[model samples]
Target: MAMSSTCAQLCLRCRGFLGSKTSTRLHYIQSHHWRIWTANSKSLSNGLFTNGSFTSTQTRQRLKQHMCYYNNLTVKYLTTEAKENKNADDTVRSTDGANLPQMPNTTALSIPENMNSLDLDAFNEPSALEEISDEEAVTIPFPTIPPSSTSLRDYVGKSETLTNLVQLGVDLWKLEQRPNVGSMLLRLDFSTDVAPRLLFLKNIGVEDSRLGYIISHNPFILTEELENLQTRVNYLVSKKFSTETVASMVSKAPYLLNFDVKRLDNRLGFYQHQLKLSASNTRNIIARLPRLLCGSLEPVKENLKVYEIELGFKLNEIQHMVIAVPKMLTAKKQKLTRIFDFLHNTMKVPHHLITKFPQVFNTNLLRLKERHLFLEYLGKAQYDPTLPNFISLDRLVSLPDETFCTEMALATLEDLYLFQKTL
Candidate 1:
């Protein structure tokens, strides 16, 4: 048999009348034989449409109508099947694939039998997407601005966690929030446990070389680490680095200088006193050092020291100081000697003043003399590689009006100097 005849026989035997009809339509659509199918029915020669015996136009019209009806019916049936499957899927709800309690309509208030016993009666119904009312909204608590570093513990305090974190230099902001890291931080054993996380955060500020340098090197950000930040700051100061170099590094940090004036003064006084006196006296002051270290002191103390030295009045003796209120340091005699020795030798005080003030000195000085001396000391500090390279006086000439303060600049430089020398 020919290919067409054999195909027709197989369709009739396997699929009855419907199979033959579908096969013919498939064959016509696939073969681009639309014109042949719609041709004359009388063209069906010898009862076989493939032969010249079939040629009637009426027969072609009937066959065309049958193919169109069959196609439409098949599409309708498939669409209905899909809809049924979707409806079945919508019935599943819980993790177990069990049916959920669903509303009959948008307006019906009848609660589902399953969820009726639960505490989610208010949320049982689907919530509207639009803002229903302020009363119905969920309130997301805003994160509290972390208390300034002054209120926090020192990285090396009783907190093992904080010490480890400070050593590693981790960024606190980048840390992934554990199940409830913030809450845990707030309520943790602050005297012991909290320091680690905070110190870790401080380290993170240090590690952000681009921005972290600003924070890490910043007196404000590193207030907590001031007592312990000897190596890094000393290295920078020893290189004869300028204040601008240090300032530029700190300008990029994310924190502000939030050290408390009164608190920091007390702490610095306690430390400075111990430094001037014998080592035996140091033990008495060491007990309270942690309290001051963990508080805001670095920035305020740094700025204040510059003002005190520049003014030529003992900071502890000044009548009305910004951060200090006179009579703060009890061992003023010893403290003044130590500061004088430090300024004269390591700082390279002028030859004229060296011979004049030789061993003992008084805070009272002629006007502008102390300021002049301070500027000169700052200059030497920047150029001297033997000490920590802090700030270059040259850079001060270029600072903006808003960011630069001659007094504060001097103070900062002085702070850097003292910090570099003695930590």
Candidate 2:
């Protein structure tokens, strides 16, 4: 009876020691049970408790039941906490919005047959962001959308500015009939802004229909200031570009009117002073190479250097060559080198003589090669260095196909045709 009383007292003390909180209760129970078991294990094993109301087996069984109950409680509490944490994580992911980076598609992560055998480390280098600076991080700008009208009629109804512009010379009916008119009108702004500029262009000899064509081709010209357009025209006139030539150039390359006067002056200077071309020749060059009016003269300058330094031509020789065939100045360096190599090293033509007949360089490389080789095969390639027939380079290259076959090659057309086919 005393032993039973003592066991009951111990059970009450153990229960009291464990707190009511579910989280800490399991921990306390585990620790306390271990201590109690370890301290009393030897006595229990020796059968000292045999005479007690509770046998050692019964005591161990009771302790085991308590431990199992606490363990089950702990598991249930942990499962409830895990469920709450998972809910929080899901809420965070959904609320992140655009801040969260996009994940790659699961399909994209599937390994290809060849890649499956390769070591993953080879492709798993650190992200470029780590190496780059904060300033270097690319800023993705929000797209900008220009204000748009639903339709021409709707646009005219809403903006009085656009209605007035249509009244002035912009053929709104024609513009409305065309596709993408909303975008075109938006770019042109209110017609009131463009009318004065159109009048300015008309005043400067751009005919009514011609002005329409210019506007159609390059509507942005309608936004240019009258004074700026007049300045470009005046600068062209000062360079001796005839009004007709200026009008033609402007009509064909309307962007020419947009260039700054200083830039126009610099290009004119390059043509007259550096290139040694007369005003008339400059106009002709511009007609042929329209881009010359706005593009950098650096390319022409570079070609001149190539002719002077690499090909060993004097300045006068280069000036004459450019005046004769301005397109030669724009030819690729490799092309010029190939022609020079053929004429100088292969044909044994002197550099001075080649410069004298720059037209020789304008001939097709294959034609030049075939004709020269055919002449050589016929044993008529060699000639006196001083005579007119003395390798008449221009005549050799510039002759038409029929003339070359009958006169120069001294062969019938059929024979030349057959020879070319074989080549």
Those runs of model 2 whose alpha carbons end farther than 4 Å from true positions after fitting are: 1-186, 189-219, 276-290, 382-385, 388-391
Q: Work out the TM-score per prediction.
A: 0.19, 0.50
lDDT of 2 by residue, 1-423 (tens): 333344444345434532234234444444554566546554443433543478666876765664554444334434443455456666778887424333222232323233212132433365666566566556634434425544566566555545655554555655665677556556564555676787777776766656655665556566678788888889888877778778777777767888889887777767778777777877788766655767666777788788989988888888778777878877777778789989989988887788778988777899889888877876667534676545578888888878987877788877777777877
Native-to-model Cα distance after best TM-score fit, residue 49 in candidate 2, in Å: 48
lDDT by residue for model 1 (150-230), tens: 333322344444444345453444332334332333344544544442454445343333443333333133334443343
Error of 1 at 316 (Å): 7.1
User: In terms of TM-score, which candidate is strongest?
Assistant: 2
Q: Which pairs of residues collide in model 2?
A: 165-191, 165-192
Highest lDDT model number: 2
